[model samples]
Target: MTEYLLYYWPGIPGRGEYVRLVLAEGGADWIDVEREGAPDGEPALSDILSDTSRHHLPFAPPFLKHGEVVLAQTALICDYLGGRLSLAPEGKKDRRFALQLALTIADLVAEAHDIHHPVAAALYYEDQKQAAARAAETFRDTRIPKFLGYFEQVLKANPDSQDWLVGETRSHADLALAHTVDGLTYALPNAMEAALEDHRRVRDLSRRVRALPAIAEYLDSDRRQAFSEHGIFRHYPELDA
Candidate 1:
């Protein structure tokens, strides 16, 4: 059994949370390298990202290292893990559909993050408060509805079951959707409340994901990081309607 090593920021649940959820649910033998400090005292995440010798260098955090393969991008990592952990559908088409849905959720996550840092990721939210407010308005009004509504339709159209996104069994895409909804609920309570009113299936899916045995335990454990200003989903009152 190859042990998985996940490299992510220590505090705040960002893109890494998506990968963590899948690993936890699958009961994979994995270590959060950064969370569990290295002997050198150097930040594990920075060490991996800054390593010039690696042929495939990730430009950011939330990368997974399994044996010699170091994979980047949240959705891509999830897709890879989905295959290894049986969190993906059996057939090729279903697996591809699952990846498609996961990527869509990733897009939504990026948009949500952009709401607070409209000007640039490097710039502080306080510096771009006015721009953030405007960006947030568009996100709450147009983007949330568009993405959430699509998920609702996907659930309805699922030939096997209405609960899971791809097939009868829970996939990585479902976890990603659940996490995205959790973030939205945390950051934009009022906006999410309105958006979910018409999305009963999506709401139910989120509830189901939260109720999973491993997921429930993980959520209650110390490993589950809290939402904060430093994370992708920041609960700024001004940014939220």
Candidate 2:
């Protein structure tokens, strides 16, 4: 059995949600360290980071410790777990396709986060309301479709099948696609619905991922955090056109 330890701020999903989705999909047992409900705060986070005694010190949250190996970056985590759990493709070309899909997911995730904090991530939304408003408009009108369209194209061009992003089997990219759709819908319901008709592949992938037993259960359970203003995908009526 492979042991997995996940270090992330538990309250808001944020980037941590990506790791959670992958772990859940893979049915891997992992610890969500530094959770709000946990005993300590910065001390625990710091302790985890400061323990230079351990060979693996991740640079950031959403980092995973599998056995003796520790890895950072959500895409790398996904790829690592995909290989460990056989969630990725077997062929080299197909693996590269999976990696490319992960990269695309990372791009969209960053853009989604910037929708609320356009100028700087360190600054609060209130501090940069004007900039956020402008950024939100740009994201709503331009960024969303451009990224979604690219995924749609990937789905269309996949020679193996149109159901999944890379190979005929479901990969980590498929899971990322589901999360992206969910996040977009929560953040911009009208935009998602309006754009849904245009991106059939994405819509289909969303539906398929939701139909998965574990994903469906997770969506209904408290383990899955809801999107809110405090989260990356914030719902600001003013931000929406």
Candidate 3:
């Protein structure tokens, strides 16, 4: 059996959730290293960066150590795993479309992160609460609609003969869309509800993806992490209208 070692902060969903969704959907065997807050959590992220002894240092958490290969970047990791899991399309255009979908997900993920820390990633959410409040409004009122609209178009235009983002069967991109929708709903329920009213395909896609056996099982299991204050998508009632 093949094994994958995924190193990520066990607590926060962050970017790690993207990789996790793919692994769960593929039913891939993997370890979630640092599986929650530790009393001495591997000497803080900065300390780990200072140390060079660690083999194959990843630029960040959510890096996958697949035997000798070390892969980073959420989308790249998904693309690599997609090929390994035969989730990628065999056709040239279909494969390209899959990559495009992944890129779009990345864009949305960044935007979501910005919602809580709009002014700067360096500043803590507490420090920038005022800015984040304003930013979240813009995101809810303008940004989420625009980004999800793009995804809506992709699914509607879906060059292939399927309901998924690419190819006929579900791909990493489809899983990604589901995860994004789930995260947004958890973080900004009001905004998510408003956004869904316009994008029927994305809303339907999210529901269908959640109904998948493995995903349904994962959601029910203790292994699935819940959204919290420290995560990328945070529940700020003030931000929601």
Give the winner by lDDT. 1
- On the 0 to 100 scale, the lDDT of residue 239 in model 1 is 76
> Which stretches in model 1 have alpha-carbon errors above 4 Å?
38-43
lDDT of 2 by residue, 1-241 (tens): 3267777877787788887877887888766766632232223456767887867777778787665677888888898888877788889889988988898889888888898888888988899999888888898899888988999999899899889898887889899888888888888888888887889889999999888887788778777888888887877878765
lDDT (Cα, tens digit) per residue for candidate 1, span 1-241:
4378899888889999999999999989887888875434333777777788878999888899887788999999999999999898999999999999999999899999999988999988889999999999999999999999999999999999978999889999999999999999999999999888979899999999999999999999988999988999889987776
Give per-residue lDDT, candidate 2, residue 201.
89
Residues 15-49, candidate 3: write the lDDT tens digits. 88888888888889876766733232234434444
Q: Residue pairs in steric clash, candidate 2?
A: none
Instruction: Determine the backbone clash count of candidate 2.
Output: 0
Worst 10 residues of 3 by lDDT: 36-45
lDDT of each: 0.90, 0.81, 0.81
Worst 10 residues of 2 by lDDT: 36-45
TM-score of each: 0.95, 0.91, 0.89
Which segments of model 3 are wrong by more than 4 Å?
36-56
TM-score-based ranking, best first? 1, 2, 3
lDDT of 3 at 197: 90
Q: What is the lDDT of candidate 2?
A: 0.81
Which clashing pairs does model 1 show?
Answer: none
lDDT for model 1: 0.90
